[model samples]
Target: MPRPRTAPSRRRRIAVDHGAPLVVAKRLALVGAGTSLRPADPNRAYYPLGVALERGFVTDEQHQAGIAYTRAFAVGLRRPLALGIASDQAEVSDERRAELTIAWRLYSAALAAMSRRIKDDTDNLVLYERWPLWLLPGHVEHEADQRHRKRVKLGLDVLIAVEPKIGLAIRETRERRGA
Candidate 1:
């Protein structure tokens, strides 16, 4: 006969460095909230970082750093850790929830584009610049509308900023194949 499993006394734990800059705590909190609120699909865990990049909420460097931090934080957790964090500890503000909703929407739009084989540079440019009109037709009128144009610009900016990183990954893959 096998013994039954038991829950750990502590679900999650982190040590504080009081001497560190305030941004350290803020970044940890951001990663914690992001990880806790992530959807069940593990592959989509980084979606919020992409959304943050798109909205200029975080710079490319910060997004990259946050990804490392978030993954580390996640690796230390047990299965029920997020539930305890969400229900008993963390106080998720309405504003944070609203931000998460926007992130989800942006991620969903990206996934839709990927599914449609819009992964090339030209297709990405078109999709990002015109996504608002197609994805939220009720809100955007003409492509020239200020609101529509702003959304388009924001999306395009994110794509442009991240493109080099994507290209580097592709180059690395090609090099590995050649080797």
Candidate 2:
């Protein structure tokens, strides 16, 4: 007889070392409020971006740029009006609307540029949405993951270009760090 399958657990166990400067294998620095708030043990929680940053796949500047893009994207997208709310009452100022339009347009241009730079469909997805480029276990050594890392760097270049201020700030940070 066929055995019934059980649902997989949403939480997974991960080893974390609180003392390490880097998050390689053993690090407890990535836990966020969302992860810690869950019923499951807090140590099991991990933040994908923090892992990515720690792994050196994406720079701090790139991370900030990605966050900015996400915020702009959210602002660009139109939200559904609450039931019984009048459209006139929910409208934003002209300047705010213009800012939103520009933000989305910038995101669109960056997307197109990144699409050109990253040819692989999966790589593009990783650049656009999927994250934590470094996964646990032996996957990091695979050729595919290496390629993903390269693509992520390229895509981040495009994102950084879209937000020049972030690049400038990054350069300043590097100078301060003597890097």
Candidate 3:
């Protein structure tokens, strides 16, 4: 009889720089990407946000809060909050589109602020307390998880490309660190 194959182990650590604006930007980008109201599919029932919650990137409370925030934003705009298309691919008037854009910007800012709070919580108290159950031993990294990570990376890339100021700041920080 053939023996069963075991999965390879992945050892990773999460580190945050509280004082670096560049880090904040990257984290904000990550959160923004992860929390996007993407379509829910069989492979991704919750899409990006669910992945973030599953991967220990964010807490359950935070995930729920994000959902509520997105819904509230949609309601404020007088739009029917539907899944996926409602937030990501909805067709709306110019004014409604502008409102959506502003709402997303504000949400992104809130995500950035939350990232800052997590970083500033020194002593790793919050980190230790919120250590995700998924990171425990015997946890297997699935293909879905890999896809989620890639999506977040792509989002970060887009953010850097679109925000010249953030890109410049990151470049300057790298130069200063001789990286």
Candidate 4:
């Protein structure tokens, strides 16, 4: 009888200057390139407001608040799309319209707070607003990128101060959805 093979471990111990967790075992960056196996990049992030969360730069409350802030922006800025051959504007429910109004208020307030708190660095506010659209696979080298991390934390802190309920609301919603 042949012996059963065990699954390989996801993490491999390796010498690294910064404390970054290794999540992936192997993946090809390009289709036809041959390269040595490398751990997942700590700097790269995909999901909305995930980079700071994954990097351990923000607390759970802060992260949840940040997520809510971003989501509010999305809801507030949403527009009815006219699909192919259908030039009619989709009607939104009264409740949904109210929700959009609330989202706009929340987004405006949070953004104002962040901008006010970091008035010295206007670029920080710009970075926070455009964070969701950042290019992927961007390297977040240590030391050099510490300022950016600090700015993120600051922005989240401002949101937390402005609306502590955002995080609580998100947590409750997630619980209801079993997420």
lDDT of each: 0.39, 0.50, 0.43, 0.46
Clashes of 4: 0
Candidate of highest lDDT = 2
lDDT of 2 at 52: 57
* Candidate number with the higher lDDT (3 or 4): 4
Give the per-residue Cα lDDT of candidate 4 at 11. Answer: 50
lDDT for each residue of candidate 2 in 17-83, tens digit (9 for 90 to 100): 5754454324433332223333222333243443455444566787666555544444445432221
Summarize candidate 3's per-residue lDDT along 11-57 as a digit string, tens digits.
34556656766655544443343424542122322244544554455
Q: Would you list the clashing residue pairs of candidate 3?
A: none
Clashes per prediction?
Answer: 0, 2, 0, 0
Runs off by more than 4 Å, candidate 1:
1-144
Report the lDDT tens digits of candidate 4 across residue range 68-133.
554444443553211111122245544444454465476456656666544322223222334422
Candidates 2 and 3 compared by lDDT, better number: 2
Candidate 3, RMSD to the unseen true structure: 20.8
lDDT at position 46, candidate 3: 27
Off by more than 4 A, model 3: 1-48, 51-83, 86-90, 116-137, 140-179
RMSD of 2: 13.8
Per-candidate TM equals 0.24, 0.49, 0.27, 0.44
lDDT measured at residue 94 in model 2 versus the true structure, 0 to 100: 52
